[model samples]
Target: MKIGKIPPDVLERLVFNRRGAPRREVLVGPAIGEDAAIIDLGGYYLAIHTDPISGSIKLLGYLAVYVPTNDIAVRGIPPMWLSIALLFPPETDETLLDEVTKQIDLAAREVNVAIVGGHTEVTSAVGRPVAIATAIGVGRRYISTSGAKPGDVVFMTKSAGQETASILATDFENEALKKGINKEVLDRAKELAKAVSVLREALALADLATSMHDPTEGGIANGLAEIAYASGVSIEVDPSKVIVYREVEELCSAFGIDPLETLSSGVLLATLPPDSVQEAEERLKKLGIPYSQIGRVTPVATSL
Candidate 1:
């Protein structure tokens, strides 16, 4: 209903209830924690995720590619191809288009993903440029965001407010500076955007992860809640274990935004078996990825 993703309850009641007939090939359809739609394709499964870049304009193309790509990666598969769409306001100029396209191309190349096809139009109906992408991948074995068990441990990779801090700093540098956030800190915040993709951490812990989720629109809290909802369990998260940046805190405080509830794209939430935690931690450590065991899944509460 707001600027970010639709709340889970509303989506379940209105959208999820209206999804068409069920099919045998549809392994994973629309759900709360499930990131991508998985379709059985004989020997392997096809994972697809789609998202739009609507909140920020600084890195339009980069965000468009990475947002959905992060979803696909959490499925324990490398994104192979993407279908992108670009919608620009009628007043948009050729130079803006060039920069967006260039960014898209470079970001796709960096991830070794191909831009298959999409649509582009300059429409007056939109007020700004919006880029959307659908990422597709195939894998033999994959983890769903709904697979967490009751006793599984929950971990969050990287920090909170990663995308939020970066977007605010980059899009509102002057405003942030005026808010008493140091220039150097703002510059560092801008660099956090590059860490938005959790492909490496996702892949490293894929085998050990029973469930994995990308904290995008609703930050770490909502992401964990989605996992708990999807798995039919409750998560006991320790807020003290969450990594929060000072810059993010200050900027969010200045704007009256709750850092924990803000958008955080780079962070990954994972649920793993108790026995597999060691291996998962080892792999992440070897890869130089930071993670924290912030919570544990509990049995779902029921009415007496």
Candidate 2:
């Protein structure tokens, strides 16, 4: 199973309902892919989002950080604190737990966010390890999944399916060490896996943006479909400009899987004005982040 689906009962028990302190400055809350629930305190607003990593345990810590934090960053929120919850099977080892914690800390460090309080537990309810993180941030402008507008350029960071590529590479290396795929290729794949976080670019784009979407599940194509359908705008993507990493291409070919259709955790998408596109390209360059002009937003019935 993919290990994701908000069950109606669980949703009603945990996510759909909440008891909170009195509110006034709340800006964004309880919205999909919103990352963080934003509460504006006048001078600065707080952005918070929660996420759990289950099936992709190999990169649990990585997704635990970016997937949730990116929510706030896309809305122009800079992460301030992260609260984590880790649940694992009864047989979960201490060493594995330590490694997961280390990865989480490293992810936070990479984005200059702090890991605050959290909970950890081992139970029979699960057969493997799973982690959830609630990321909080500060911002002035608020952006959500429904933030796109007609005529905004839809730009994405990294090629699609970087994470899936890494997985295939790892799986392949274990299976093909006896085959002919070279160590250099395998090493590069690991690097690509670790390079999935997009906090910097997301925050930068939020400074002046229409909307942002991270291509996670279903790659860029599926993500574009979600944005267009959600915001009621049409999108057109140029396959040539979409940047899929060289190693990911090779890996996908090896697995007989379509990289464009796989799940990519590290990809970031932004919709901005056409005029600022060039400057944005330079900014991505300076960050050492690869991107592409894959598509544009237009007024239409649905996403192309």
Candidate 3:
């Protein structure tokens, strides 16, 4: 009944339970923490995911492409094709449509994905424009958020609430300025929008990751909670190790939002073996992506 993602218990009861009979072709089906559905396609696995952008209208098109694509990427697959569905209100103007479609085109090209097919329509079924994208890709190996094991180190890419900062800065600039945030700080926060894509770092670290999660609606806190619940493990995170960009801090402070619990599409949370930490850091540094060792996974205690 919330505006964001459904609660786990409710999802399990209403959605996950009615996912139909298990099929041999479905290598990975619907689950709490799994990013995309993995289907066995003879020689390789097909990773597919769909996401809708209804929260922020300013970046709808861009978010439509990258959000779902990030899901497929976290599965260690390069998204190759996308299908977008654009639904607009009856009063929507032609210029808005053109702008959104253009953004969709530019974003798809930026990620090297083709717009294979999609549907667009203006109807009274919605208040504002909504864009949903489904991304598909093929890969030999896939990683799931449930794969994190005991003794694995938890890693986070970029900073906390990067997406949140960008969204607030872009869509709520006036409110931020009214709250005493300077124009320069707001502009810098807006720049964070371009860094929302985590495909590069996800692919680069996929090989070393036991599990990967794209923190979205609930930021790092929810992402970590999902991984822990899915993997049946306990994760201890050091707050000091989690990096929060200065702009993000200011924006969150202005809005009274907890950065750790805000939207964080750009951040990639992963778990890796202790031995792979050095290699992962090296690869990230070479790619110029900042990261941090935030925590470690441990087995949950059980009564004997």
Name the runs in model 3 displaced over 4 angstroms.
none
Task: Put down candidate 3 lDDT per residue, 103-179, tens digits, no spaces.
Answer: 88998899999999999999898998888889999999899989999999999998899998998998888999999
Candidate that would win on TM-score: 3
| Per-prediction TM-score | 0.96, 0.85, 0.97
lDDT (10s digit) by residue, model 1, range 1-304:
5766787789989999998888999988998878999999998989998898878877888888888999999999999999998999989999989988887898888788899999999998789899889999999978898898989999998878889888899888899888888888888888888888889899888889899999888898889888988888899999999988787787788778888888889899999999999999899899998899998999998899
User: Model 2 clash pairs?
Assistant: 35-49, 36-48, 36-49, 37-48
Q: What is the lDDT of residue 29 in candidate 1?
A: 92
- Candidate 2 lDDT over residue span 1-304, tens digit each: 2354454357568875684765677755654343456677888777777777674666677768877776667667777788999998988788888878888888889888898889999989888788888988766667776777888888888878788877656645766455455677777877886777777898777766787876676677777876776577888888888888777787777777688877777788788888888888888899988888888898886445
Sorted on TM-score, best first, the list reads 3, 1, 2
Please give the TM-score that candidate 2 achieves against the real structure: 0.85
